[model samples]
Target: MRSVEEHQAVVDGLLPAMPAETVPLAEAHGRVLARDVVAQVPLPGFDNSAMDGYAGRWAELAAADGSPVRLPVAEDIPAGRTDVVPLAPGTVHRIMTGAPLPPGADVVVPVELTDAGTEVVEIRARPPIGSHLRAAGEDIAAGTMALSAGAPLAAAQLGLAAAVGVTELSVRSRPRVLILSTGSELVAPGRPLARGQIYESNSVLLAAAVEEAGGIPRRLHFVPDDVDQFLATVRAELAGADLLVTSGGVSAGAYEVVKDAFATLGTVEFGKVAMQPGGPQGAGTVDGVPVVTLPGNPVSAFVSFEVFVRPALRRALGHASPHRLRAPARLTSSLRSPAGRRQFLRGRYDAGEVSQVGGPGSHLVAHLARANCLVVVPEDVTELPAGAAVDVVLIEGALQ
Candidate 1:
């Protein structure tokens, strides 16, 4: 059996780097930037007022000597207004917040400091020069790098891009993944189950996981234990797909449809890894799209995705940190694992303690759903006592 790192290396070697595409800024949120975004225009665009007040020459206002200095308002300026006229030498201009400051104006006095006059304003206090003013390019300069490549466009980043007059962006194209779940005994949800039928869920589970990993997922109907049908289905879905992910039928079972269909294709290699609950794994390509085949069990399929496929998707989409957040926590109970296989047990971590959520069974989907983390046990050690420090991969939000 292969080690986890060896299998991961095989899987990572198969994925091609995603190409960049141009997208409107409205659609760029959550997408990774493909190139450094240079500022098209300086932030604030021009010298503007940071508050609603009077824009005047600071030397004229200071000449009043702590008394109320009345001056005729030269012009009224509101935000987004063009046709701004220069401020008269001795008069003040009524300006609104974000309005462009008139030429020759050296300072702004907030309306609260005066009598809030519109025609003839009373400046009760003398503000410092350049007070309440936003200079051009103060926050960001034109032609300077605003955002770097490989950074995810979050809300603040998007707002900054818009502030710099950016209407579109170059970003990594989201990978399109084709998902298939294969099993003869599998039945779709909301349908009647016969004697030995179980509702197929791995496709939906994996599809959601793909979306969370920043890939677009297209789920195909479940393929039964027939080699011809499986091959036909794969061929049909190969068009326009960047990656292929299949759950089930790769194990050493009598009716392993995926293995029988793809074993002859020189691109795919089927094998086991030194990991519990997700030992059976496969990685290769069909046609030109990369293919990853996970084990049949639900928990095993999900764990395989978290360990291998999710990081590949993130890396292809230009993410820098492409793995789950891992931290160490003290074990709440004793646990045991096989001597040679590394164990990823379903667990719930809180504060500094981690407790096993369910027994080490691959079929326990309920327990897996309740788990927010995977308690990692190394292959070298078989037993862990309570209070032992264990490494855990956090699948949900951070432990509180």
Candidate 2:
């Protein structure tokens, strides 16, 4: 059996970095920057007022020590106003927030300091020189790097790009993943189930997981356990798919269609890993296209994706930190695991303590739904006492 790290490396090698593509700023969110975003124009672009106040010469305003300095309001300037004139001596310009400052104006006294008048305003106090003035290029200079390459574009990054006059961004493209689930006894959900048939759910689970990992997922209808039909269906749907992920039919069973079909072609390899809940795995190229076969159980497929496929997809999308966020938390109860096999148990983590959500059963889909993290039990340890420190991989809404 292979170690978990070995299988991870195998899956990682299957996908190459995606090429960069120019996308509109509206669609660039959550994508990694393929190139540095250089500012085409300086932030703010020109000198503007940071407050709604009167713009005047500080020397004239400061001459009144605690006395009311009265000045005639020459003009009204609101935000987005252009064609501003220079401030004439002995007068002030009533300027609104974000309005461009008139030339020769060095200070702004807030409207609250005066009587809030429009034509003839009263300046009650003297503001310091350059007060309430947002200087040009104060946030970012023109032609400078606003955001570096390999950065994930989030709300703040997108806002900064727009502020610097960027309408489009070059970002790593999302990988297109095709999901296939095969089982002869499987039936679709919401349909009547006959005897000896179970509702198929692996496709839905895998598709959602793929999308959460930043890959576009296309789920194919579940195929029967026949090897020929599976092969034909896969070949027909492999066009334009960056990665083909199939659930089930790869285990050591009598009618494992994936293993049986691929064995004849001698392209895909199947094996077991030294991990509980997701031991049966396969990763290889099918007709020069990448393939990853996962277990059919719902919990097993989800765990396998979180362990192996999610990180690989994120790395291919140019994310520097591709792995799920992990932290060490103290266990609230004792746990047991089989020797020589790594165990990932469903857990609920909160405030430095993690509690097991369910037993170590791969078929417990309800328990997996309630879990926010995976408590990892390493190999060579069969038992753990209460209050033990174990590593937990944060998932599902566990990120703080």
Candidate 3:
């Protein structure tokens, strides 16, 4: 009988943020940095024209009304060449895009405003001191922290790292995960299923979830409902993984192989939480390595990943803020939950409000597949009416 936040606290205690490893910029995507990434040098390095335009002092724009200010074209400054000196007095510089501004010039006139009067074009408008010119450090400054430790190494973050002279960065190492599924009536996918056997989909789903959360799922270890065999298989898989995650066999049935096997191994602590579908949860260390065992239902398994395992992995990999964003939306239909335990209802949401995509039962798989959101109905007094404001677990992209 714990609140959602309380269970979250228990899960959080299982993993702590750790330092990062140095990885090549290309491979560092989606990893968290170990430390702050600061700029080694200013971007743009110098004042350069933002456009292919003429360079001149502001005084030239006012003088354009008079007889053409046909000044001598002092130095031709093209893009990528820094050898040209500043504009000389009473002289103009033919500047191209990305070309540095001469030391003496404080303005730029685009190439379109020109005449065939002489080799030197007539000046028209006066560009301000910083107009069109990208001054040094305008984008980024030297020695400034661009990416902080525990922040995700996203595409934009990587680009910023490169701008700051970071060829490789110290990032969090992806945890090696071993996914094991237990059941007597489970058959692998793409095969002929028997009368009592169902396709084993939890391993595939769990593996993908592991990869998406930045962990490396070694492979699936499927164990039939034989207690001795399950125990033996789990030991063999644990030897190679940093952490182990298993689905099924933790429930209260006599055939619950997982619950019985771990009763003496000192690895799993079995308990039925005050929640639906996913109420059964267990976690502990087997031979010094961390392991979390989830309920068998497909919806329960996926929800367990979102609620418990994913955040744990993220925290272990050095994520500062690892929880999903709770987006508030109006419920389009009524919902009722068990009086005591909290519920995670699978749902689909559109622009403004949300409608239940699947039944509230944890056993419903078709509805779970169509859902992209989890409508969080708290343990408090229970009816969530249509158009009611409820907190929704948004599995969608970050709310930009």
lDDT of each: 0.91, 0.91, 0.79
Off by over 4 Å in 2: 63-65, 127-129, 380-386, 397-400
Per-residue lDDT for 250-329 in model 3, tens only? 88888888788888787567776676668888887777777788999998998888988998888888888878877889
lDDT at residue 294 of model 1 (Cα atoms):
98
- Residue-wise C-alpha lDDT for candidate 2, range 275-360, written one tens digit per residue: 99999999998888899999988888999999999999999988878998998999999999999999999999999999999888
Q: What's each prediction's TM-score? A: 0.85, 0.91, 0.92
Query: Per-residue lDDT tens digits of candidate 1, residues 1-400?
Result: 9999998888888787799999999999989999899999998799999999999999998755668899999899999999999988889999999999999998999999889988898889888888999999899999999999888899999999998888999999999999999988889899999999999999999999998888999999976567887898789879999999999989998888889899978789999999999999999999878999999899999999999898888888888788889989999999999999999999998898999998999999989988999999999999999999999999963234
Instruction: Name the lDDT of candidate 2.
Output: 0.91
TM-score of 1: 0.85
Q: Best candidate, TM-score-wise?
A: 3
Count of clashes, each model: 0, 0, 5
User: Which is better, 2 or 3, measured by TM-score?
Assistant: 3
